[model samples]
Target: MSELPMTVRVDGLPDRVTIYEVGPRDGLQNEKTVVPVEVKAEFVRRLVAAGLPVVEATSFVHPRWVPQLADAAELMTALGEEGRHLPVLVPNERGLDRALELGLEHVAIFGSATETFATKNLNRTFDEQFAMFEPTVARAREAGMDVRAYVSMCFGDPWEGAVPVDQVVTAGTRLLDLGAGQLSLGDTIGVATAGHVRALVAAFGDAGVGTDRLAMHFHDTYGQALANTFSALQAGITTFDASAGGLGGCPYAKSATGNLATEDLVWMLDGLGIEHGVDLGAVVATSTWMAGHLGRPSPSAVVRALAG
Candidate 1:
């Protein structure tokens, strides 16, 4: 592991970085077997107890598309009245309706930065997906609900490699203009390097998008998520999305793996003296519990080392 910079200036460090725990939704959604509703709720509860401000609880997409999240409505109902922001994925109008019916206050919409990914993931062209989100975004805003947009394959794509920087900026700008309160740039396949992270952040900045409205969602496919994250931090971003036990994978991209581990991120933040307000010990315990339940070792190196 790289040592924390000893003499780095503190002025460029963000005031704080908001870690959005996506274990319950994005993590569990990729599991081969159906995790019980109680298990899902317990996982979410543990994350909340660990002081996560935003927890993506579930996705309201059709069961045929993602059988893992077939119980989205049930999960939302089970996690009733949590004080923290719990957002669910809304793929389109039908998903949005289900989310609203459950009285959800926050929702997330997703689009891909690459044309091939957009077509494969959403079964539509990039323009089509954007147009589809138009009414849904407007409706969510009118209902006074917070909306977040995810631009997947922001760094690279599995089928279509090396996404252009200009393409990512355009997609991000469109989402922000469409009433997305925040935009999460997803390194969906974990193919991003520090150079890619720096370049993309620069692209967003040049396009007049503030770093405050952006978040980094990286997968550790090549063990580069943390390094890329540091590059993003230097580029003025403050929000990040992580998963417990590093549990998540891209359904559309088969080669992709879990996200950057929360434990690892917290450990890094602690070394840098960054304030995340998250309990690293508690996060490890939760990851351990979930890993045992799933019958697999944690993907987080920090968690494994700490356990030893």
Candidate 2:
């Protein structure tokens, strides 16, 4: 295991990055086979041991919706007293209630920027979807929990091509208004280019959503996730969402692919001398172990190249 090179000064890029690890939740939820509660817990423990500051532990969505994460409660219980900032996905008030019962303190709410995706993913209109999460985020904040809102399909939608930048800003602003302190712009279909990434971040900033409150979550379907990440970094976004081993994709979006791999992201950050407090070797080991559990090779190019 080699050391990461010394941090370099990249103009406009943050000196430190907060990688919100989503492998245990978003990454595993998309898997066809149900991961055992024990494996999920161990996976999270490994990620934390590898120095991830924040990890999304699991989603509280109904079992029918994401059968893979059906043991959300049990899994959280198994991760008892880790003292990590484990943020779980709460689809609505019910999910939030369930999470609160376990003494969880952080949560993420999700909504879509495109009407087609909103309708298809949540079975609700754009307004209806926000209505669903608004109360959830409100109650969570009242309970003194930190909340993050994810705006999915921000760049492009499967049914609707090229989502307007204004639409994404509107969705993000609404979430910020709903008491979500952080908003993650998701390229759910992996259709965003570098130019699109910069423009969207700038639009949000113009709408008064500061880069400090924004995060980027990209898919590697067309292998643009890292490029989009760099674009966002230049745009002053310091937080990002990634999955270990590139383990997840949008089940709702047919053309969607695995997420930006944690190792891949770290590799680039290492070379650029940006300061993300993650061990590249440790993450590669974690992802490699997880891929074996999934019975497939890792989708991360960095992981493979490192193994060689």
The most accurate candidate by lDDT is 2
**Candidate lDDT (C-alpha), each:** 0.88, 0.89
- Model 2 scores what on Cα lDDT? 0.89
Candidate 2: tens digits of C-alpha lDDT, residues 128-233? 8888888898899999999999999999998989999998999999989989999999999899999999999999889988899999999999989999999999
Which residue pairs does candidate 2 place in steric collision?
none
RMSD after CA superposition, every candidate: 2.4, 1.6
- Over the stretch 28-100, how does candidate 1's per-residue lDDT look in tens digits? 8888868888889899999999988888999998899889899888887887887225898899999999988
Provide the lowest-lDDT 10-residue window in model 2: 1-10
Judging by TM-score against the true structure, name the best candidate: 2
Off by over 4 Å in 1: 1-11
What C-alpha root-mean-square deviation, in Å, does candidate 1 show against the real structure?
Answer: 2.4
Candidate 1 TM-score, C-alpha based: 0.95
Off by over 4 Å in 2: 1-9
Clashes of each: 0, 0
TM-score of each: 0.95, 0.96
